[model samples]
Target: MSFLDATIVNVALRTLAADLRTSLDAIQWVVTAYLLAVAAVIPISGWAARRFGARRTFVAAVVLFTVASALCALAQSSGQLIAFRALQGIGGGLIMPVGQIILARAAGPARLPRVMAVVGVPVVLAPVFGPFAGGVLLDWAQWQWIFLINLPVGAAAALASLRLLSRDEPQASAPLDLPGLVSVCVSMVALTYGLGEMGRDPSATAVLALVAGVSLLGVFVAHSLRAAHPLFDIRLYRDQVFRAASLSSFLLSMGMYAGMVLMPLFFQSVHDTDDLTTAALLVPSSAGAAIATQLSGRATERFGGGRTVFYGALLGVAGGVPFVLIGANTPYPVIATAMLISGAGAGLSVMPAMTTAFRALSPDQIGHAAPQLNMVQRLGGSIATAVLVAVLQNGMDSHEPTQAGTMSAFTVTFGWVLGAAVLAAWTALVLARAQRREPPRVDAPAPAPQSRA
Candidate 1:
């Protein structure tokens, strides 16, 4: 639901502008507002769980997301939709991390691989399908249904979480790190705002916010060092395996999410495709991801997370090559093949890296680690989007308005995506080496069966 919301509304942005009698600049806030809200709220998920118990927090998040979605559907103007989207983002942001806290604590190290596979579904595929989903709703129904569709799913998820999730004892008496919360929230909100703006329009205010965000983040880190019961423990990175996994996840996400943007643009601009057809072309990629998610856990268990991630990253790099060379006349089958390979690469790598990180930590540590992991991944996606979109937009602006010129712009942007994928592969190798250097974690999984020589 969260990831879907992240990308789904994009297909409707132009329609939204027309419907609401708003400018594209104003309508873009529908996305920026949600992203800013999500960024602002994510750091608090672990703290929220610790304060209210994971079950309660998760349910409340679902309810809030659901309620906000309904409000979004009912929105009478652009401002109302944007505000409601922000409200929805607060809930969308909390859902994943806190749910991870609950699941990781419950699953323990041994079951985490398969458990994470389950969690990876929406995380991996939602963005892939968002446009298709949105296109369908708009074609068949109303733009409002995009938000309203979440109503049933969100309600079901909330009820399920309430019934199925185990309730941990809440640390009701834990003192809030008020300063840490404010600094982190401000930093994230500012940084996301900057990145979001940079993607659509580069401006002086965005640059200032970016600098302010970085400065405040430094201040937050310093504060966390000294504050007792800080909002989240930055010290977890002291564990080499955890640190490697964190870096790998961040880098891999930079490639994966940014790549999603490129192909859709490629099909639309170069191939002269409609929204649904472009989205339909992504089905192969989505299928590949689904298949990889199921297989990644077993592969991780047999080969180790780092090794599995390396192989997955390689696949992603291979998948990316087609795009870097894509043209207006690029074959559809070739595009579909690349999509599958890239999607599989993403599925194969992302979870194993995260699973590897959690496996290296004790159950008690997951609560401390999960939110930060989610935050870094979120930041990675934001950074990637900003970089890629800005590049593509600038290229388009500078180039002649021709099919070949548009193709050239997309291909150049995709070269950056490929570079990020290569970087992701390098980090996975680093993660593999780091994993080897570490002593056996207290939460290590069962040994792989010995191969016959």
Candidate 2:
């Protein structure tokens, strides 16, 4: 529900602008505010869980998210909606990471592969399905239904969580790091919103925001080193396995998520299909992801994470090759095949990489690590979007809308996606080597010889 809400409202942007009697720029805040709020709140998830038990925190988050969703549905103006969306984001941001913490601690490192596969189903499927579902809803229902749909799902999740989740003891707490929280929140919100703006309109305000965000990020890092109980422990990166997993995630996410933007444009510009038709054409990719998720965990357990990721990245490259050389006249079947292969590769790689990260951390560290991974993945997607948008815009410098020109623009960006996949493969190999170096040797007993000595 949280993941779906993040992307679903995008398809409704135009409709929102029309119905609310506002410009696209104004209605965009409805989405932007939610993302910024999520970014701001992510660093606090660990603290929240440690302060309150996981079960209580999870229930509260769901209740807050569900209540905000209901409020969003009832919003009378753009301002009201954006405000409520920010409220919703505060709740939405913690749900996934907190849930990961609970499951990771319960499942233990041995079962992390299976756990991640289960956790991954909705995470992988939601973004792929969000826009399509939204398009369908808009075709047949009112705009409010998009937000309203979350109410039942969130409520059910909350109730089940209350009954089913174990009441684990909360960790010993220190005073919240107010300065660290402020610095991190500011940096995240500014950077995320600025990059998002850069994708749409590169303005002075966006540049300033980026600069401020980077500067504050430096401050936060410095402060974290000195603080006893910082929002997150930066030293986690000292673990080679965690570092490698994070790098792989960042690169693969850039490659995979670009498709969310690129494929839709490909269908609209080159094939001249309607929204519904384009969405239908993309179903194979989502299906491939679903299939891969079911099989990837066992593959990771058998072959190890490095080999699994390496193979997945190879599949990604093969899938992306078609896009690099694509022409305006390319058949839909061919494009569909490329998307399917790409999505399958993504689904296969993501779970193993995440599980690998968790395996590198202690149970106590899982809460912090989960949010950090999520934040990095979100940042990766934002960076990929900005980069691709710039690439596409540069390729279309002549302002031509011809199919050939559009195809050229997409080709350039898709080439980068291919390059990112190759890098992911290399990183996976590195991660494998690091994992090998990490295990300590178990010595055999010296038998009766020691007694004689």
Candidate 3:
């Protein structure tokens, strides 16, 4: 739900502006607000699970998100909608990480690869499908349906979480580190919003926010290393496998999401396709990712995550090759085929890296570890989108408006995407080498505990 929401509303932004009688600039904030809220709140998700217990935190998050969705659907003004989206983001942020923490503890290391693969389905598929889903909603119904659509899914999830999720004791009732929390939250919000601004408009404000964010992040890191109870454990990065997986997750997210942005734009700007048509063009990619996800777990189990991720990253790099040469007359079938390969690469790479990160850590380490991994992935996508969008925009602005010239811009953007994928592959190769030395520790099976969530 969190991931889906991240991209779904994009298709509705224009409609939202028309309906609410607001400028596109204002309506865009509806997206930015949710994104910033998600990023800002993520740093505290570990502490949330620790304080409130994972099950409670997860359920409450689902409920909050669900309620916020209803409010967004009913919102009468742009300000109200943006506020509701931000409210919704708080829930979106917590639901995934806290749920992962619960599942990680339940699965244990021996079974983590397979179990977390199940968890990773949304990570890869959401971006691919989000625009498609939004286009469907708009074609069939009003814009409100986009927000209203979350009602059933969120309700079912909350109810199921209540009944199926096992309850666990809170790790600590200690007070949240006010200093660390503020520093990280402010840093994330500033950093993400700044990144968003960089793509939308490269103003001095964006530069200032980025500088402030980076500076504060440095402060938070220094504080975390010294504080008695840091918001998240910086020490987790010391583990070589965990470190490598985290880096792989970050890089893969950058390429994968930026490509998602590029795809719709390529089809629309270059091919003059409409929303529905572009959505349809993305189907093969979605299908490939779906098929690959089913196999990723077993692949991780058989080959280890580093090998699986490295191989997957290679597939992604192969997939993007065709796009570099895309022209006005480039065949649709070829583009579709390339999308499939890249989607499969994303499916094969993303979940395994996340699972691998979790697999490297002990159960007790999950609370601190999950948020950091999640943060890096989110921030990576945000930063990459900013950078790639800037590159594509500049390339287009400088080129002639002809089809050939526009295609040139796309090719340059795709080169950057390929570079990111190659970098991810390198990181995964490092992980593969490291695992050979200190192999992923598989814990002995432990008895399941009986409890009500």
Among these predictions, the greatest lDDT belongs to 3
Worst 10 residues of 2 by lDDT: 444-453
Question: Which of 2 and 3 is ahead in lDDT?
Answer: 3
Q: Which candidate is the best by TM-score?
A: 1
Expressed as tens digits, the lDDT of each residue in 1-453 for candidate 1 is 888988787667657878999854567567656766776677677667777887898899999999999999999999999899989999998887776666554465567677777788887887688877987888788899999999999999988887887767877545777888788878877886787667557799989999999999999999989987787788889998899899999988887777655566667667777667777877888888889988998998788889999999999999999888767786889888998999999999998888888777765566566667777777677667656766777777779989988888888888888888998898899889888877436564321111010
Off by over 4 Å in 3: 13-32, 74-82, 163-172, 195-203, 394-406, 444-453
Per-residue lDDT tens digits for candidate 2, residues 1-453, read 888887677556657877999854456667657766776667677677777877888899999999999999999999999999999999998787777657645554455577678887876776578767776777678989889889889989998998898887777667777898798778877876677567556899989999999999999999988887777778889999889988988887777667765666567666777556666777888988898888888997887776777778778888888888878877878888988998898888877787777667665566567667777776666566555655566665644778877777778778877887888888888887887787411221100000000
Better model by lDDT: candidate 1 vs candidate 2? 1
Give residue 181's lDDT in candidate 1 (0 to 100): 76
**CA lDDT, every model vs. true structure:** 0.78, 0.75, 0.80
32, model 2: CA deviation in Å?
5.2
Q: Name the TM-score of candidate 3.
A: 0.88
Which residue pairs in model 2 clash with each other?
Answer: none
- Collision pairs in model 3: 167-453
Between candidates 2 and 3, name the one with more favorable TM-score.
3
Query: Where does candidate 2 stray beyond 4 Å?
Result: 10-33, 74-83, 166-171, 193-206, 386-398, 402-405, 439-453
Ranking by TM-score: 1, 3, 2
Candidate 2 steric clashes: 0
